[model samples]
Target chain A: MGEVKNKQVILKDYITELFKESDMDIVEGAITLELPEGPNEVLLKNLYLSCDPYMRNRMNKILKIEGPATLLVGYVWGFTKWEEYSFVPSSRILFKIEHTDVPLSYYTGILGMPGITAYSGFFEVGLPKKGDKVYVSAASGAVGQLVGQFAKLSGCYVVGSAGSKDKFRFSVFVNTSKSFANNLILHASPPLHLNAYLSTTILQIRYFPEGIDIYFENVGGKTLNAVLLNMRINGRIVVCGMISQYQSAQPEGVTNLKKLITKRIRMQGFVVRDYYPMYPKYLEYVLTKIKEGDIVYVEDIVEGLENGPAALVGLFNGRNVGKQVLLVSRE
Target chain B: MGEVKNKQVILKDYITELFKESDMDIVEGAITLELPEGPNEVLLKNLYLSCDPYMRNRMNKILKIEGPATLLVGYVWGFTKWEEYSFVPSSRILFKIEHTDVPLSYYTGILGMPGITAYSGFFEVGLPKKGDKVYVSAASGAVGQLVGQFAKLSGCYVVGSAGSKDKFRFSVFVNTSKSFANNLILHASPPLHLNAYLSTTILQIRYFPEGIDIYFENVGGKTLNAVLLNMRINGRIVVCGMISQYQSAQPEGVTNLKKLITKRIRMQGFVVRDYYPMYPKYLEYVLTKIKEGDIVYVEDIVEGLENGPAALVGLFNGRNVGKQVLLVSRE
Candidate 1:
């Protein structure tokens, strides 16, 4: 195959603060569409790209995505680059998309890493019981959305916050750079500063004066502190990500940790990598839930590979409404 | 029945800061040495009074103890008044001293609350594995002492601190008040302020450069923050008490909680009441260990009930070492 014009999004530098569109550079690159000779290699015409919080946190320093003509791609090396065409090692790919009935873009969200993350973090780690008062931060996002739905499915009462999920109160929209943006979902006045997020969250948690039983933590720092104060006896906190603290030199101090002892609470952190073994079981259950209308997933997809940079940075602010995905190609 | 003059340690008022000897007043009050009419009432002479960190913390506000008199007592009413002789509802007493071969005072610690606390907190909540690196704060105290021995019993590497144990580095003798005192066990310069406790702990953790797999958390606030920094991936922290913050009007903030997510740590808080069901099993195991000399306990015993006030206040400033037991009368 001849070299095809492949547009790319390259991370210009390591982000120190809130992610900016200028931090990334869009460039046109070319790649041969032929699969290079390798034992477990396949040429993946990048269809949808995922933008997740852990992509930056787990990587330690920066989020890197190779533009077109990516010679190497593996799950261990992170998702395929934000480009049109790429060579992917089959061994590194976490799973194959067997069910085509759902939107192919779903692979980047409810059917992918974010999906399993919510599955294991909530059910396995959180250990929700029926009638449990569950709280989810970053609720409009990929994993948070599923956690809320899962809580409800487990016969628990769930309250979701972050972005414009009308059912949830307080827009605690946390971005990667730790810079919060315009309020979109808060019932009362939204907190402008990052530090004030905890006080406001504590105030808003008054809605559940009785207390939260299971807290699906996505945005850490202040929100986590607030959750600590509102946690009921024997409550469980499933720490999945600290998106609010990703860009921070020093993450905020959580003061109410003594409550863990006072209330007999359990806070646990888990990585999806450990839970991948149960993926097949999770898939059957989740797919069935999706078909039965028991669960819902919202995707905020930006079309065209060139818009990938904008969509990714949008995650830092409340600009993106749901699971942030960039469409690289229709294939 | 003739009324007998009974000595009692009375809590004068709610403590504001560090527990002062003046906070408790020793008094001689009269009590009828007769069994009460209640079905489970027992006319008993108080032998030993236990001074525990939780006695001040779990009660929410001030640590209150009634002076000896012809009055009522229940398990929910906290420990029997720090007294010489009293009428105790049999229901209020946690257990009967079954094995007399051991010190009868063992009921106040190793064979009682502190014993089961270390057992359940270490084995049940911590979920420690063999060869795990375990760190215990307030290591010379009742619960921490046992937690360290339990870690060793579990075939894990144990490092303990607080109150000149020679074996463990750094004297982190946390009292009810946040005030730190003259360094006791510290090989290096002891941190002066309460805030520096975290940074110093983080520094000392370099001894176990590899990382801590289990942190038996006895002191909360700063030390807890320090443990988070040195925690290995998949570490477990058993939150037993927050002795450091027991007297503070506002507890110190614990930063580094995000490490829970990065390292996939599990921190759980448990009450001894929950583990009482397994007391028989724990008693057998601990008694056998004690007889085998596999475990050692230190007790800073005050000879008379009059000295109880001094011994109790001594706990806040590293004055009392080991279990901090007050000997009212010996059988």
Candidate 2:
């Protein structure tokens, strides 16, 4: 078991420039299959790797580096590269896969961290009710897709904004760029000159005519500003990820925060780690939904560990159409 | 009743420039003190007028004009002038004052709108637990003063920022400008050049060594930016008011919103109206505290209705040391 060669992705240097695929170096390494001599540690084979936007923050020096490279770690840790056959501590592995009928890659996404994120962020933080008007950004991503489905299941009118219309088959697929252009044209008339600040507001009003009750914030910046204006009184904004501003030199200032007070909006940010106790419940519910065909997921799988860097970097540029997954091993 | 002279304060025109005493006009007019023929309407003499920072927004064309001139109206209404008498519709009044032993002006501050604002913003929105580190901005003002006292009662370590040190005896009164200067001097060394963004972070760290569990935000802009960086994981910021930005041509953009996700903070904005149902519970609790000498209030009273404009405008400049109140005929 100790003789097996391990392919590992290593962060060669902390990113100084906008993150690129070259920053991460894939190197061939070796690790023992046997568990280390500790009461708490366990050895397991790496199956599927997740390509998430949060990993970009880790690549830069912004996020702290710690813990094993697996789901449900005690604390948020740095990302592991396109790697295979790595031995992680026991606690790092949230729960062992017992259900084999579902794809093993689902654990890395819809059945794992992203799954719980969508659940807790939408239900707990978002506080969605029946007939709620929900708007989700990055609609095709792992978490956003699940959030929209959950909202729809709750009898909500869900609209999603994606980088491109092809990203997801949403009830209303708003191409963010085209929407902005339309907003400019609509507000070009006299007595209503729209600036970048007001333009977002005008565009969002056009998208969600009745106003949004729950905003599942996946991409922050202009999208967040736009949603702020269109939010109904007592609206809830669940901040999951700010993928758009993750690699920017300076984060864009949210100018429409005044609406928060006027509309009495609640904007809360959450990490999935905080709600790990509900993972079992979430898994049961999501698995049932998947089985019932009530919840559908879209995965953009990149074969081989070598393509991991490009797949991960593609998240920032909105290159990947869906849940970006790096396939590490068949086992 | 129609023969009585009504000293009226009327908004002569919408303000385009920075607010001044001249924005409001005082005129002697007449109104029937008798209620009009309506089942929902009641007529009462105007006892004390509350001078609040939110009124600054109404003074400009920003806030919509609606409803009558009194505290806790059905909806947030437009500003009224520095006049002695006026007839307002019955439903516009939230609740009739039942207790009279305390100053009638207390209804305008500690017992009325400001009192509930503090109660809901601190307990409901801020969600401070025992022994939590709490920070309150605009410490000496109506809402801020009560928030600090409430936090202390809850066994939380409380700190407050005020325009002047003499304004309310808080546990810690951070003179904002002085704190900023100190932050600048402390970060004069290499690798720590403080910009507008980083400077606020440094200042907050100095004030809150253990990080803040809850921030009772009243004065936003730079103060909000500062509190964001110093927020502990899962911290709550109750956005009660942004007095600093109410009169600005363009509200300052908050740049460190990414910290919301990184720190898992919940920044919620609320109006006191949402929690009006809890007014009874809050009033009883506050009245008990007042009787027990557990709470003390300070009111900066401006005598006469003519001085109302100056008192109202004084809030923007931080001129009023405490709860700014206009003595309109203390019936």
Candidate 3:
């Protein structure tokens, strides 16, 4: 391995306001493609990089940053840019690609961290039983789509809410512009009118008439508040992400938390890193689902490292149609 | 058994605004002190009545009312007034008075619903470990006091916040007036300056240097938001009650819910009815603690049924120094 010209997306400055593409600087840098002499060091050509919502949280200075530059390829190493040909610690790579028949890019989205997130969040946290009424927010995205499919596989009546109608098979397509108005109505009204607005709650009740047993929380904010209203007794709210509130100057205040007590709801948040040990089992299950055509994944691939900054920022704006991925190289 | 003059306190109307003493009507009524001809009917002289925060939720017609008039006393029977003698179902009496060595009023506080709430919320939901940092809000209240004691017994470092200086041995005495100002400062600042205000977060950090492992959430609103800022990784927030917001026309919005995802926090709410099966064990455990003098319970007893309405209303006003109970008649 030799030093190579690496086209990189550098975080020139921490984003103080809502994320803009200009916040990232695309710079031409050189990297020695050889692993440093250490017991736990791995060298690999970056094939596919994932654009996740949680990556936005890292842009803020409050959260702790840990691990090598290329470790998770996205979350860790605050200064690590969208670069080509980087070296990372061997331990970071939880598993090596064994099944080459599938697209290697699948490792970044459907078969990687997001896959484990969907698996653990849905099965362990959500605790969906047969005939359980399940509701998932941001249902077209990386994790939500899998969560909905997983619920369907468990004989649950799964309803998904997405930003647009064309993204995926969403039960409710929430128009982002109208959603703010819906949120205002849901928050202002004390008696939670089911017919007042086409809010997440009304749509949820319309789809799952019996009320939501398990809520796979991805978008958070108004969706979370709406779900809180429609949750059944002893309902489970698996808090995966709050993507909607990440960019706001002041995060929205959740007023309907009292419903948690009345409904005996368990709202829990978990990270994929904690559930990494079960990756092998999850991989097998997800691979089988893909092979059987029971699961389908959509990826919005943006070519070249220079376009990575735009693709990453596009996530906050809900610009991408599916799991936004930056194709660094074909490998 | 004959008909007797019963001085009753009837809810004049459903209170949509903050609860006031005027909302209740003291009426002269009569009740036959005889058991009805039914297998599951029990006619007993109402001895001690409990004034709990949950009763406020019932005042709003949104929450479901289950069982006959006297079960949990105030929460059920929308029309059940603050009365002297009442007819109730036999099954409603969850426990028979096994030990008379303690005050019968203990059945309303330490030996009753609040006792179970503390035990289960702390042990089952909070899941505190040895050396864990525990913080309880409304620390001198029925449930909060016990939760602190229980945390201490489990070899955990416990800190409690109370509204007044005289209420029990609170680790931090949060002056209610100053607390409101502190809450304003805390909410206004996004960066969270440690020295800006002696807010719940600062007081919490002063008590638990390592951050909070378990937060026994008896008082929500501002305290909850402050606790959210200082929660340790994988922290447990047992959602017992939000007494601060129960009376308000609009509940406060919790702005720091993003902390849930960052810290992988678990916030769960449970009612005592769900954990009734654990009553025997909790009873034995609490009784032993009382006998050993490891736990000390204080009750603010208002004598006579006429004072019941005033005492119940006093709970909202923070007039009661301890567990507010009404003495209906001597055993």
Candidate 3: residue B260 Cα off by (Å)? 1.2
Q: Which stretches of candidate 3 lie over 4 Å from their true place?
A: A1-3, A32-41, A62-81, A164-201, B34-40, B62-81, B164-201
Candidate 1 Cα misplacement greater than 4 A, ranges = A58-78, A163-206, B38-40, B58-78, B163-188, B191-206
Query: What does candidate 3 score on TM?
Result: 0.86
Worst 10 residues of 2 chain A by lDDT: A178-187
Candidate 1 local lDDT, residue A330 = 64
| Candidate 2 A-chain TM-score | 0.84
Model 1 Cα lDDT, one tens digit per residue, A1-331? 7799887777776666566778778899888877678778777667777877765553345444433221222322236667766666767644666777888777777877788899999989998889998888888888988887777777777676774222223553322221122222454544344335545544355446788899899888777887787888899999998777776776777777778887899999998889888888998999998888667678888887777767766676667777887776664
Superposition TM-score, candidate 1 onto the true structure = 0.86
Instruction: Provide the RMSD of all predictions against the true structure, rounded to 1 decimal.
Output: 6.4, 6.9, 7.2
- Residue-level lDDT for B186 in candidate 1: 54
Per-model TM-score, in order, reads: 0.86, 0.85, 0.86
lDDT value, candidate 1, whole model: 0.71
Q: Pick the winner on TM-score between candidates 2 and 3.
A: 3
